[model samples]
Target: MSTSTMNPETADRSRRALAAEQAASLAATNDWAHVDKDRVHRDWHELYGEIAAAITAGAQPRDEAVQELVDRHYAIASRFYAPSRDAYLGMALLYAEDDAMRDWHNSYHPDMVEFLGAAMMRYAETRL
Candidate 1:
């Protein structure tokens, strides 16, 4: 199948829905307080590198990679921290505020939404 087969708009909508659900699930949990900050940061960096590599490799369909990254981060975050809607929203906002993240987000034109959605989901999963 071609990349064109995966409508960017539709994929973005699906990703956003997933993110919202994950965020809500996280909000319902209570495990964010004990999160290991250093470890989560390290893992985030590692995953970021992997994502960069995937893009560099010219991977045909990057959504899967994005999804996996999102899933992994969410799992890690949920395991590490306490559930707080404000904290989750803050983290997501922080990413948008960072220059590096902005660059990374801009690097992939049509896929940026997917990447952001994945990141949000990952953050949400941390609460679970």
Candidate 2:
């Protein structure tokens, strides 16, 4: 394994810690008054699973079908924050570079984070 890559146990711990920190931050800034947390969670889980299946089926990041998936991903994300083009690309960077986020995404498929990041980048550049 690469020196930069954490071991599974360490990665899990790191992910949990990061999640806690993020949740705290989000709670402080976002009003959760009307949101259905469970439904949003389910939507994200379903979307991630679909994206994973697309990757496993050899879909390229710029493929039309893959772009459709990215569209849904962006729409869902916009419910929380509608990012500018640069912000969306920055998020793509996080998907591929953040250890905890990358590992969480990769759990769906070995290349899920990279695939999704590329797709998101493409979507941002061309569509957004």
Best-fitting candidate, scored by lDDT? 2
Q: Give model 1's TM-score versus the native structure.
A: 0.43
Model 1 regions lying over 4 Å from their true place = 1-33, 60-62, 80-94, 97-128
Q: How many residue pairs clash in each candidate?
A: 12, 0
TM-score of each: 0.43, 0.73
Clashing pairs in 2: none
Cα-based lDDT for every prediction: 0.53, 0.73
lDDT of 1 by residue, 11-75 (tens): 45544644665566657655344567788888867776666666566643236665576566556
Off by over 4 Å in 2: 1-34
| Model 2 agreement with the true structure over 42-115: per-residue lDDT tens digits | 88899999999998889998999999999998887766556666556656656777789889889999988778
